[model samples]
Target: MNLPLHPLHLKEGGHVVDFHGFALPVRFSSILEESAAVRERSGLFDISHMGHFEIRGSDVVQAVNRLISSDLERVPSNKALYGHILTEEGGVVDDIMAYRFGEERVDLIVNASNRDIDRKWIEDRLPSGVRLADHSDGHVGMALQGPMSPRVIGKILPSLVDMGRREARTLSWKGGQFLVSRTGYTGEDGWELFGPSSEGFTLYSEILESGKAAGILLPAGLGARDLLRLEAGYPLYGQELTLDVTPFDARLDFAVSRSKGAFVGKEAILDASGKPIRHEGHPALTGFFVEGRGIPRTDCPIENGSGAVVGKVTSGGYSPRVGGGFGLGFVDPAFDREFRSGVSGKVRIHGQALPISFRPWPFVTGGILRAASV
Candidate 1:
């Protein structure tokens, strides 16, 4: 397959690896080193493959609010929202980031693999006057994430540093203009930049060079990105979230605005919220820390005290910062109490049972300095 490369991939001797059909860098340096760098200092990521769309019309906000679970009415221009586009039955279509451009315009950032599906879904539900345009092809995106990301990038791009979390502004840098948002997937203070593809390459080079001079930033790869996001308690699309699962099941009720009026999945979601919690039929997403070696991989069966299958692992890996294995997976809530009572459930990995215990999300802390200040 012909793999597509992000602009940054062209600059950093990025060893291209096929990731879900897109050519992405597995690592610019070593995965372990890059992973450690982001946890300790800062790292830059090339995420241009993510999809972008422009929505415009008098009814754009209304149309968008109807399509997503987030409350868009209070979302000011140049601010972004993290939420999900849900099916009429309340199942998640995709986890997305929405940016309000103006009263009549908005932009949507969606997962790369679901780009076409997301665009089509948004268009199908748009009111008659609304217009939806796919801009993924023309724009490029990148993220600078970690504890030192804000200060480092701020020194190079002063305007971006001043922008608070979820805030965005159009600024000029390296002889070009770009839209920079103070946001990231990794639980840290950082910025995500979007602009013309050519200028994106220039900005990527400049940022990398600037970070190099600062000696605190490095080019991070997908491996580091996964570990950082996991530690931060951020869910991955296909893993922690999926079409078979509703936002409520993922413990993302905050994203669903009950007072925002009717949306595509409003009725179903509201009904689900009102019903008594069921401990069976569906699995509850929970966090777990491993007791021994051998990282848990996806589809690893989770068994209860009596050796009965309660659920299965969805995402798991070692936390370099915590120095142990941690993971998120679906488990029967009925047995949740048992696991809480020291029942000692085990995760089946590679034909061996690895003892596990439940742990809370956000295995890492202290990065919410900006949000806390607010």
Candidate 2:
């Protein structure tokens, strides 16, 4: 897939890589530099590759409520809600954010990789009178994040500078209008903007020019984004979440609404006892920090005292903010009970079971300048 920002990335000397088939920037300078920019100052990311879909009609609200696990009853107009889509068997199809505009119109931004599966799953169950449209081709998306993000946005969209978290508002620049939401995947003060694909290049340049004087905003890419989300304890679709992993296993209970009544997979997700099942391995994704001088990688075996494999690392990296190597892995919740200060286990690194410790997934709290995406 081609990105609207590809030409700009090349002009800026970004190192591009194939991420889930789309060629995009991995970094403009260094991963550490870009990641630091978002944490301490500000950064802009091109996330145009994510899938965009919309549902509309008088009954769209009701149709959406039945499709996802979250209760949208209180999701006020011009705000967004995060939730899950499940198979009848209770496994996750995709995690999504529903942006509500009115009683009838709603836009969904889902993971880019789950484009076909998520659209098909939702459309198949869409009720009569509701309409679904894939808007991925019509728009380009960008994320502006960090403590200085609000200041940068103020220069471009002064009206949106005061917009509350999770809220959406329309803004126009250069005769091109679009939606800007106070939402983001990174654990920072950020906003996601969706506008005409034709205006993408101009928007990127404008933001750069607007914030360059203050050294607050810099172009960032996937490498920095991955680390920032991991630091925030957010789950990546293909990593912590998968078709085989339910929201329960992902520790995303806050997104599920049992009291909202029926939704897809409500039955299979709950046991006869009316609770989310832990399924095989009793796996639950949790965060961890390296005990000493070890780095963890994906698929690294997590083991107990008896050296039995209990879980595997999902995402791990050096956390520049924490000044330590950190990781996220799925482990038996029962093992979590064994924590004194932290859960000690053997993390198979480089063919050796290096001793490791498991703590809560979010290594840092309140680091995000704004409210979390969900």
Candidate 3:
């Protein structure tokens, strides 16, 4: 469960923790400071614990297209597509990124916690002539994220800085193969590097040290990442998304390809279609902010002033960007719609119902969606 960057993190004063079986840095400095570094400039993050699976063969594209929910026909080579791997019943198995390397090969980046399960799920359905390889253990991953991330990365890998959004390229570094993809979890322009462990460590160290003179690129951790993603309105796997929740419930409809024809979970998802069919009285995910001193935490019941349980907080915390409490949770569709229009709701803490309201979306945005930010 030890990450390839474990030693490097220790050497750089990262406060490490046991996150989903792997030793991960919770914060390099304070979470707020690290987050500010990303907002204002850039930050480096170690995400090696995430799973990477390579599928190659003549029918690779067809196999991947049939298994995942996104329309891959349009995603050209050297590009990445974000989508969900779902169960037949329309439940999300895991949200993953598929890096298309033409019609013959693909690389899927999946969540660390669901690595084995996803691999098993995917491999079980592989057709003849297609190959599956769990290359996660052999490589390390790092993210350089922020608005000025390109400027910072330009110092070392100038060519990769302009690879365009969701695009990927390969390079040879220190006698090892390195892949740089313009992809990230935080809603910002960034690059994700995947390569041999030693090379990855070198890349991380070089970027942090070299970028210091130009722009501040701090070493970020899980704490800042969570807050940034929340502010970006991005859903976490175990939180807003789960095996019990369909894409409709999670508001991940964009990733679901209804026109792509016959993929896993398509039938049930079409039937569910924002209803409570899956969870039976289900609540769709929504964003909210707490006023004053109240900070909502996961599993806290959300009510509508009449003392009736509408939903529960899935991810909640203080946002440095919001300068107040901000979190995401699932609530009844009607209640969510009402609160989204600026109407107030209540979050039950202990026995007190503190007033709260839905905070539209992309709480703070400097993401690929420039129009949304504007």
Per-residue lDDT tens digits for candidate 3, residues 226-344, read 88887788888999889888888987778877667678777777653433245566678888888767778889998886778889899888876776877889999888887877888
Please report the candidate that would top lDDT against the real structure. 3
* Worst 10-residue lDDT window, candidate 3: 365-374
TM-score of each: 0.92, 0.94, 0.94
Clashes of each: 0, 1, 0
What is the lDDT ranking, best to worst?
Answer: 3, 2, 1
Clashing pairs in 1: none
Candidate 2 segments whose C-alpha is farther than 4 A from its true place: 271-274, 280-282, 339-343, 369-374
Give candidates' CA RMSD values in order: 3.0, 2.5, 2.3
Comparing 1 with 2 on lDDT, the higher-scoring candidate is: 2
lDDT accuracy of residue 236 in candidate 2: 90
Q: Candidate 2 overall Cα lDDT vs. reference?
A: 0.82
lDDT of each: 0.79, 0.82, 0.84
